[model samples]
Target: MTLTRRSFIAATSAATGLIATPAILRAQGKLALRMGHPHPESDSWQDVALWMNETLNEQSNGEITLQVFPNGLLGNDPTMINSVRAGSLDIALTGNPFFTSLAPELNVLDLPFLFRDRDHVARVLDGEIGDRLRRNFDGTGLHALAVWETGWRHVTNSRRPVVEPADIKGLKIRTTPNPAHIEAFRLLGAVPTPMAFTELFTALEMGAVDGQENPTTLILNSRFYEAQKYLSLTQHAFTASPLVTNADKLAAMGEDQRNLLIATAQEGAKRQRAMNAEREQSSLEALKAEGMEAVEAPDREAFRAIVAGPVQATFAAEFGSDLIDQINAA
Candidate 1:
């Protein structure tokens, strides 16, 4: 059978056909795990969340039911990760700069124009480099279950459209509070104001920051157009959210259950990436309908030329140039 994102979701949603009664389920004592993320329920992470929840509920015969908390209900990115590490939360899907904020080495992947496209990104992240980054969770209180693409990061502003490299100069842009992100924009000539994702909309509306960088899925889903005017398809970098669980909690699960959970996570990751790609194409039109103006061919090469050297140098000095070479070679 074909396994498109929509098909996968439909399959999973119907997975609970043989679900047990609440009383019987209560007696059976399910895992009742909590999974939290900062994105809206309409975002890719939530798509993954819903799929995993239904799949686990069916596959485990209701012994494992994930209680998902979306829209930062459990907390913001760092708080969610910290909760997972402390064993207070079962899982969290963390976006860039959040994962990089905790593990500085992973910041190398977010450098401007590093990923050529989604295929190149999946190749690198699902290969040796991805394994290396995931392994960094070892000895930390967290266990990395899977990595999913949130999609290609773009540029949006309440000011002028980012048509060229020079257009970004002096405009205060909101960035994730990761060193690499802040430094990359600084090198690209924007004043990078790092802040929590929860505060971004208000910041833009208040003119606290003239712009922010995020994927089109997020920009449109979160309705950033209400606060910003222009959307530029920079596709400068890729956004990835790592599915993480508390090390101790995950280690205590039975081998079968652990394997099942990982399998479900992989399935969700695959579907989520495909869904994000499809959503990006449609969301551009949705954003325009909501009053966002799209700028065409915003000198992607020019943006890359200006930021590549300094940003790559920053990464090389911090993570060793050899690693950068390895990723480029990947």
Candidate 2:
């Protein structure tokens, strides 16, 4: 039988009760892991982290313990990533775009307008493209456990509704220090300011940055809408976060333990995607209730056209024209 969302939830609920099953306890010993992400405890990323912790603990019969540090408790994404690389941290869930700084070839995933939707993103990442990206981590001292999708990113600002490319003119938009993002917003006529995720709320509230772009789930969870009144449904980019582990730590685990971890992470990814989709659909209502003016602009195509040229020029040499052609075709 096909597992609908309801069935999946029911199955997970049933599985939760099996936490103390003897069979799970015999295969995997008690293990503790520290995982970090920059978002707050209320964010979907944190929710997924908790889900992974619960699922792993249950599946391993309380043998595996996951401690999650949310809200940049272990520093920012880059810092957490470096910590994992150095083996100071056991695991992390981080944005894929940031990986571009470490492995430039991975930047192919960051290509603007590359993903048409969630299904398209999944197809590429779960297929050959994902395997190749995983191989890039082989010598980097880290293991890519799973790639999970974050919802499509949109724009939120205190400035005004962004109906067209020109509407963003002169707005200082806070972006992750990812070059692709900076360039994409620059093409949209905004002065894209790269800032750490921790600094964004203050930046928005203090008027240091006039706006920022993120998915609906993030904006709502981060409470950015409380400070910024305008939300533009640009859906300009779709994002993924990698569930990573210290290579040595993963290598030390027995084959059964390793398989369990990967399987639990995959389940966590599935749960996260479903939770994000549900939150995205309902979040607008919450935002509206909070007095934020949500605008659905009709000119997404115009914004896409503006960034297409710059994205191609920026990564044409690395991605090659053929791959770009294929992604665009899809």
Candidate 3:
């Protein structure tokens, strides 16, 4: 059955009210968990999902399995997250920015020029700083399983190469509805249009928006180079995919089942992060090979000078600088 976004959400919303649970138990006594993500099946999100399914199925002796939905078939990131929270969906994998409204403190992760490199990001997310951030998910109806990597975001536009802060001025850049992202672009003098990822390619192709920002893997997989002419290695911010499940769903499982789920998720997170890091440069080269005008070195320090200070200050004033301070110290 082909389900439109409206129908899908309506069905899931109705399921939330009508069904006491997500109906994980299927015929022949198998428990099938439904997992959805916004990325394509070829992306790391699906890769990890499949791995978890196989591993869990093997470990559980076919007692448990996963039914995967990729390419936003369930809905956009926020919609899938709402489904997970409302108990209509079993699990969702989404970038951290989408969770900020549920736990506003998560906005810290999206701040521009936040981490020095992938190593810094690993340190922050694997250490005490990661624990503090995940704790914010409590009471939000979603339980964080693990944080996976999405790599650093860069700018791709039809206008021109974004070599410096001035080059981004007045470009209609499509950004996630993340306050930090929108504000950073606004500060850089670009008009940031907060749009859903599903609508982004058409928006760029139709010229509704001039360009967008995302990791290289996504840009290549989505073929943004078809619409955008320039690829700037802005490395503006790092995005983390927090794989989460409904708290109720987790509680419904047996103790052993719950433990198995958490253990498998964390294991998958580590493998996915390593896969993403290893593919980062190769993905960039692939995009360039596909004819993207790659700006190998943008004036990142100059861009940071304009964006980081004020953005961090605004965030600090609103959320208190504890998370940011801790991340920096880490």
Candidate 4:
């Protein structure tokens, strides 16, 4: 019997039999998981969220459902995270840095030059290191379902093209509320201002921030080009956005439902990563058409060197020397 993905899922559901629908599973009383992210509905993050909703619902035969709140509708990343911890929010898809305040070990993934490329990021994430990070979330009142890459970050601004570290001097850049990201731009000579993703477009349009750094897909998906002109391919950090659920809510699920949720999340993550990569490739052309100067071959190593030492020192105490060595070796 050739078992396809859909067939395998159906078979597994049959094996689990007709499980009693928890009161929370009723149509009127369905447990609605509120997932928050900073991207609009058109973004890749939303694509993944929709996929999870569809897959999880089908797998559980409508017993589990997800309600997505996109474009920071619930609040900024930090606010959303706090809500999740407090059990007010059910789930969220957010950058790892937001959770660093809770789990410092996650900072290892934020090191400026740690990942040589996308493949390295995936290898480490899908390997023991990723498992270790997931394990660390056990007692944090949250459960990490999967880690998905957002591609390498690049700098986009209305100022002059950034080809070297010195060019970024005095430029006001908006960054996520991550210490490492703030320090990175500060070390590169830009004044990094931490802000919510939803506020970025307005901040740029109003000249509140000279530029910001994000992946190509983000720059295009968020229509950052409407407010910025120059894009520097610094490729500084490869961000991992984890799909996290409240531990209490997750713990209440049956074994079959739990397994299905995790499986669906993993599958959704794969789809998200592929969509992000595809968007990254085509975003340059889209930006160019929009009259944005896409700067290429910028001295990435020069910028990397600026933040390398400080970021390493900041995280060395948490990740310890061995894991850092493993990432460096990779």
Candidate 5:
């Protein structure tokens, strides 16, 4: 049976009743917030989570603090995201793809070769384009707080180097369940297998999939180099992690408290973005040091030329080209 978001929520709703909320509201009006993400404790996601916790404590004069659960302790991306929407979880951090089902307009950001660089991403995501996409969260039970960078995604495989589109032909590549990503890989001549990120490493180790694509930071932090042999700097697409909270929960908070929560999250996002950029080269170097062959200059133009037109047209037909045009113009 296929599990849609609604069904997943229903299936998990009963289970949620058994889990206690980690947050505490003191008699003195102080509140503790709980946040969760799928990345390990060593990744930048955890670093920012801790940073935000400190900032929130200091800014709130000890009235507010965060309890962070990393490495999918709460659940995978989709589960945690649904928990937040269902008010069982306070907050969640997940890549754009995980939220696309709740807001399909976000698929625009998942397009291959869509973002030229970090600057282009900043221009779009930190501007009106980002605001418009965040508004899409309304009525979905999530309050979009801020946009954080996951960096440009690259391809890694155990089979061989993937420098051009043809190199990946017939190879099974694991991808996020984002339609744009699946469509892009399919157009590039590879079998696109979509699955949860949690299953990727074991699948690769067991030869369930030949390769996978992810940000250099995630590839290194997740230790994919142990199972994958080649690292191609495809930069096929950029991913953004949206920090979101339960919409009803946020609305229930005092005006000042709500503003503080949003403001601190955005500030944390800025720091995470800078840190992500600083670590990109170092992460790539670390992957190479780990014995993975690095394809420094893969034929990006060739790869992009193959998937750009068709993928964009297919998405535009469904989502309209106005947002795409706005992003391009930005």
Candidate 6:
């Protein structure tokens, strides 16, 4: 399930059988495009973005050139999303949970323990539920091309190990500004504090927050191990990042180029998800080597049993029982 960057690019290039240098594309009306995300350069998504850029450049015979912005250099999720909507930026890859601020329907995905694992996530996001979520972007002036992965989220803290639901009580935990997640954590007896990822390490180091939750890729790449001593494999929720673009911008690209972008992005997401799944164990081991202890086993059912009723009730009232039920049934 693991794929190296070089091998990914080689496979994409070989599959397309269409190759051209950037210089050649520049001569043939190259369209300069840009995509941004919040993760550091080491994130699998970043590599996939770069891979998509190169594939598009060659696939379009240099008619399309994509520039990638990593580490929030372009902007955070909200900022980049606004820029893309304004047509000032080309594309973005961000978690759907964050998009709830704009489109509340996205909250359905952030529900705790909503997805069993990566395959379940893929099943939910690749089926009708996924299509409906993608189309929901139109109201926000964005077009979603493919839904990507951020893997499952786990907990890390500087205080002590978290192996039981009671162990989390009174601890200030960091979370994205999603109501469902915040409410879920609150129901778990933890004080949920929403903040930007860029400020997380300093927050943890300064004791601004006791712990945070994120995927293994982010925990390792962002070096959260330096400030947090313990990691619990909670796998409470999986993050789905939609690779999107401005609706108007996509329309202007014409049929062929637009299709190529979508195709390359989907392929890139496939490889990126594979790379993340492959890296989970190695990344955890690396974190341990770097001095962070892993609470390898936790009582998932206990955690779920406490939060399930309240979260599901809240989601049903806000998003309708049918929507939540559909996701569970899927």
Once fitted onto the true fold, the runs of candidate 1 whose alpha carbons sit more than 4 angstroms away are: 1-29
Provide TM-scores for the models. Answer: 0.90, 0.88, 0.92, 0.88, 0.93, 0.90
Between prediction 1 and prediction 5, which has the larger lDDT?
5
lDDT of 6: 0.82
Residues 26-96, candidate 4: write the lDDT tens digits.
Answer: 35534545566877667788777767887777877777776666777667888877777777777778888
- Misplaced by over 4 Å in model 6 are 1-28
User: On a 0 to 100 scale, what is the lDDT of residue 42 in model 4?
Assistant: 70
Give me the displacement of residue 258 in model 3, in angstroms.
0.6
lDDT measured at residue 194 in model 2 versus the true structure, 0 to 100: 86
Tens-place lDDT per residue, model 1, 1-330, is 432345345534532441221211233556767677777767878777877988998999888887666677767788878878877678888785787756778887788888877888888889988898888788778888888876788899988888998999999999988777788788888999988787888899999999999988899878899999999998888878789888887788778778989999988888998898888878888998898989957999998888878888988876789878888888
lDDT, candidate 5, at 148: 89
Candidate 5 lDDT, tens digit per residue, 1-330? Answer: 422323234324533443475433455878778787887666788788878888888989989987777767778889999888877778899889989998998899998888877899999999988998899999899998899877889999999999898999988999999999999999988999998787788999999999999989999999999999999999999999899999988888888888999999999899999988889999999999999999999999999899988899998999888888888888
Error in Å for residue 8 of model 1: 21
lDDT of 3 by residue, 51-82 (tens): 89889999989888876777777788899899
Q: lDDT per residue, candidate 2, 168-268, as tens digits?
A: 88899988777778888888788999877878899999999999988888888889987899988988888888888888878888787799999888878
- The prediction achieving the highest TM-score against the true structure is 5
| Pairs of residues clashing in candidate 5 | none
What local distance difference test score does each model get? 0.80, 0.78, 0.87, 0.79, 0.86, 0.82
Error of 4 at 269 (Å): 1.1
Stretches > 4 Å off in candidate 3: 1-23, 26-29
Query: How well does candidate 1 score on lDDT at residue 197?
Result: 86
Error of 6 at 204 (Å): 1.6
